[model samples]
Target: MTTPYPRVELGDLPEIDVFSEEFRAAPWEVTSRIHSPNGLARSSRGIEGLTYQSAHTVLGDRRPRIGFDEMYQATGFDESSPVYQAAVTSINNLEGDVHKVLRETLGRYFTRDFVQTLRPVVRSIAEEILDGFVPGEPVDIATRLVGKIPSRLFASLVGAPLGDAEFLEKTSDALLTVFYMDNANHEVVEKAYAGLAAYVEDLIRVRQSSPGDDVVSYLLDVERSGRITRHDVIVNVTALLRASTDTTAGQMGLVIAELAERPDVWERCHSEPGIIPAAVMEAVRWRTGAWSILRVVREDMNILGTPVPAGTDFFGLAVAAHRDPEAYPDPHTFRLDRRRPKPTLNWGMGVHYCLGKPIAQVEMEEVVRLLTERWTGVHLAKPLVTDGEPVNSRPLTALIGHTPR
Candidate 1:
């Protein structure tokens, strides 16, 4: 039932200053050291937990719980606020049987078969975005080409009309600020959240009268069947929209930057399109999109012979795990032919594995393929940079590039 994780012996791991400016600038260095085969490290944030930079240990063990609701509460948003209420009940935040039922109810829509159905639609969106890219001119790949595709596609998928796609995109960005930005105030974040929720509520009402084959209409059917409440539909749909947008866009930007920087890899992908999928997988592993996830220990257990007490807050350093040399040979090197005989936890693992991974993969692959095909000559025109921390770190922004295809 569990995936095998690389085991490590108990050894000395230095206290990782996750909040330090140096750590922010280059997280992989600290994460790499933390994942040494003989040690485990703690963060300075007073977060009591085990740090597993190895894929086998973190992905294999399913005993820990994702502490989303706990983290939400720490942000001082109680059930009283509409944004807080919506989030706490969301599929992303729910736990136990509730999480299971909601996940099952929504899982069918995200299956490989269903995701495959959207290939034409997703491809068309990519093509439209690419149409705007001028061959010899410099463009901000992170913004003009990469950023809008996922947001627009998500709006279309969730039944938001073409006219509303831009609006939805802006609001979604504002709403997601709560998760990643340090300056995020409840007022600004909640206002953005309320706008999105209200817009979705209106969309739900419209679907109720004129139903269609989109997710909103599907959720309306579930609501009518009495399986879930209206609140569940609204909040979970919000979660889905949020899930499908930002991270995919962020990762796509990173992938494109990688292609631009590594012309050798880009040329290979351009020559043999089939290698693009494998290249995307390696990019996903190399990029470390979803860097870390938290888990609360259910009971006392020995991790690497170290006593981890009950109620301990465990932080799984997924970025570190992806770069663990024990799991991935020459972990820091980026090669298209890197073996992925087993799944990577870049999206995540266990019951909380990303439901929208299919969508993300399709989006990233299509973008890479299209870019390679159309813009044969691509390179970064400016420096590719990231925000300090891995969590909520924007992907290779300022990726202005010249694409002379």
Candidate 2:
């Protein structure tokens, strides 16, 4: 089989230049430009590796190592190196084991029953935060409110102490920022890994001595039962915090920004209060916190007649796919009434789909519902725009102002 390294002019495609000032100034426009059907076509450089059947052949039921190896290589981590191998093994093991254990271990914490039970607590927290918001003040809602709520909620869910929650949130954000761009410096990754490892190690010991109803405690119990090892516990806990904090915080900011820009949607939610769940899902489809999932072609394949060679890198751009006009008519416009489409592959399509989707949906729905019920005539202080290179949807930078009617 021919190696499918099809060559194309890279500069013709809107560069995925994440750090450009123009991108930072007008992210949504850049996103729209990059994700346009034509833009997507241009962005399809090195796509000789993406065949129609590529999804199945490349990202099948079982996890493949070729993608991990390629990612390591692209990131300058040697695939043959012991550290890279260990990290890959840890990642793969965590993905599979966490999914399986999620039902038994974390299912209760995030279940509909539990979420409904926690609604009052979540609302109380929301109100407390809003009550403290000096009305008419231009707040960095993203950093102040959006990031705080989810981090605290997640920490409570995992039984991490409140103080440590703040530290974990900061570390998680830095780690995610680095990971998302694949630009994490060695020191940054090392520090994050070390800090998180130390924190989890301490939590595991504490939970061992005094088990609680929270997830960490439960996972410790599971480890004791030989269902998982100490290393498994650490990897899964690290995954949970990383997955829960950054994405949720990012989505919260994006949704708030979206609502701020579209007063009609905000007013609808404020008036009805029941449509927030649908709105949250719509926002998720629009923002898509995690941008792309990388896969590797496992064998020779053909996707829509596009040839894919074994071991070639494949990228499924979730944000771009969500905006496909064929998938959603006039995809640019945000419509709450847009017949709640099936959960966009925003989370993912196949076996490697995000494990925390249910929890995220619940958290988003709760936050939106609470915000709508508590405020009216919520208005934006500045025009909300996607101002940055398209990294997962838009990196909702600044919300100049907001008010409660």
lDDT per residue, candidate 2, 1-405, as tens digits? 222434333333334543456644543345556532123222333431112123233344354432544444444557665334434554333355554664455555556677666666666656777788887677767777777877787777777766676887887775555344363454565467678878888988888888888878877877788866777677767767776787777777787776766678878887877788777777776766655556655676543234435655455555555665656677777877777575575465565566667666766777777767655645556655442434454445555465556
Please, what is the TM-score per model?
A: 0.89, 0.79
Off by over 4 Å in 1: 1-13, 34-39, 46-63, 181-183, 298-304, 309-312
Location of the lowest summed lDDT over 10 successive residues in candidate 1: 46-55
Candidate 2 stretches with Cα past 4 Å from truth are 1-45, 48-87, 90-109, 180-184, 383-387, 393-396
Candidate 2 global lDDT: 0.60
Give the whole-model CA lDDT for all candidates, comma-separated.
Answer: 0.70, 0.60
> Among all windows of ten consecutive residues in candidate 2, which has the lowest summed lDDT?
48-57
Q: Which TM-score value belongs to model 2?
A: 0.79
State residue 100's C-alpha deviation in candidate 2, in Å.
4.4
